[model samples]
Target: MLKVQEIRELIKLIDQSTIDEFTYEHEGEKIKMKKQILTAQAQTTLVQAPVETSPPALQKNTAQVEIQPGAQQHTEVAAPQVEEQRGENLAEVKSPMVGTFYHASSPDAEPFVKVGSKISADSTVCIVEAMKLFNEIEAEVSGEIMEILVKDGQLVEYGQPLFLVKE
Candidate 1:
């Protein structure tokens, strides 16, 4: 639980620092923040970006988008590696609502599951906190968790993939 002033202070500190990203944790709360230095070209050329899917912020997934002068702008994202790696058989566990993701009931508790952990359809995999409500998320598909997509205390969007399960 970070105070608003604390967060503002962090933003100021990070802005002044040379680092582009920073992560801090204290008393069961974890926060990861990043700042991007966009050129005028990049800013003016970005396609319609979803607030939930800030593709450019991923950096690794960024593609070189070139727009000819006076031409129309269009969306052209590189195929996500997750899609390529998950293949056709993987099932994604998606968030039911927009919220902050938590890996365990408590920060000190063991995470519900990890990569390679087997799960039943009803097994609790994580929790999503929305509007002060903590909702336990179940692994709807019985399988092994191949990947955990969201980080602890990270904001998640409705229908966003949280885990990849192999059934």
Candidate 2:
């Protein structure tokens, strides 16, 4: 079994390097770590094989590690793509997590922010539901909502632009 500090070090290394995934197997232990660009996080799965088993079979055990946005140096590469898709004057409100996008707090309520709506840095423009958790996404920039890039109930990945604003 790998120690917590060792696992942390591995995650740090993976976060700094360009490798998106890493796996290791030795004796009865196996470890797998995969980096997800959208959320700037990494998930690790560890499997231990029973000594008595004729053929080693993996046991279900998993752990997840989240690297902060600052640790994701590769995200800078995607900035140019977004700039190319959107004009220089437009600011994008991106999804911070991979989940279903909802325009309003509930289906019966009016949408949080619509086209032509003015928003400030703290404005809650939409909700992103991931693993049954509803997270209110803020605009993070003051601007007028110029476009809604995604539809309600649509699945959106991390870093996907949900709305375009003219700042």
Candidate 3:
């Protein structure tokens, strides 16, 4: 279990980072947070409900609540699109958890696998560090790495594609 302060800090970090969602589990307690954007219709519903209850008092407040269409836009971020363009069969190695992706065991060491490097099913392709724990991510499929979708030290979310492999 995480403390309240720790959870607050985690939320703050997620808000500041580019990650869309975060999930953490410890001893059976799991916490997940996702960034949400309110649609224009939803925002209007939220503001209109309170104004209808109090007419005079919230008359000034209603004027201040302006619902601008396409003002606060929400753009969907696309996941890595490292599909095989050569028509060869390809497999994706996705991240299992949300964390900082590391290409090597250490800062000075070489990357575990690069483009054109052949890997087996159980090969350790990368590491994801979450809350001081280093998790070894496996290839899960035998193939040659065709493209690395993420850069070193990049923050990745769960189910995000890390590499495209030619199977």
Candidate 4:
């Protein structure tokens, strides 16, 4: 559990720190956090694991996003590999709620997609976990993965860009 001040401080750190993962605990509560950077977008995730009965963040499938401080900032990113996709920017796929984003269905598994991977409109691009429920994230448009906006296991905000795909 986190106090209001602690949450505020965490937000400040989130904004300033380039590191993607953060964790803190007190008393009987334990928290695990992770962040990642692909393109310019960011993603984050927070998990509470107690000493007993470690909650399965996702038992079926797990997406891991690691946000590190040294990761490149999206806004400051350069378009080095997107020469073919020039003149048109990648489409942004953002989160609809606050939760964890997973690239794979489970831990020790391959991600759903990789950079330059072609995705279709009905593709199951990723997963977002909220309140113990895992939600499937689909690509609304078809394109090539230009940039991964967020990291795996990242905690994402509502309407935050998750991936940038070039059409």
lDDT of each: 0.63, 0.63, 0.63, 0.57
By TM-score rank, best first, the candidates go 2, 3, 1, 4
Query: Per-prediction TM-score, please?
Result: 0.51, 0.55, 0.51, 0.49
Q: Give one digit per residue, the lDDT tens place, for model 1 in 1-167.
A: 55433443454455445666676666655556565544322222345322113332232322222222234323232212222225777888887666799999998999999999999989999999876889999887888999999899998765578999998
Off by more than 4 A, model 1: 1-86
lDDT of 2 by residue, 1-167 (tens): 55543554454455456776777666655556665444432222323311111111231222223222222211111211222135877888887765799999988999999999999999999999976889999898888999999999998764577999998
Task: For candidate 3, write residues 121-156 as lDDT tens digits.
Answer: 999999999779999999988989999999999987
In model 2, which regions exceed 4 Å deviation? 1-85
lDDT of the structure predicted as candidate 3: 0.63
Which runs in model 4 stand beyond 4 Å of their true positions?
A: 1-87
Residue 61, model 3: lDDT of 12
Worst 10 residues of 2 by lDDT: 50-59
Which candidate ranks first by TM-score, i.e. highest? 2
lDDT of 4 by residue, 1-167 (tens): 45433443353345345655555556645444444334333222233311111112212211232222333111111111211222466677766555899999999888888889899988888999976889998888799987888899898765567888887
Output the lDDT of residue 39, model 1.
36
What TM-score does candidate 3 reach? 0.51
> What C-alpha RMSD separates each model from the true structure?
14.4, 13.3, 14.5, 14.3
- Candidate 4 is scored at a TM of 0.49
Model 2 RMSD in angstroms: 13.3
Clashing pairs in 1: none
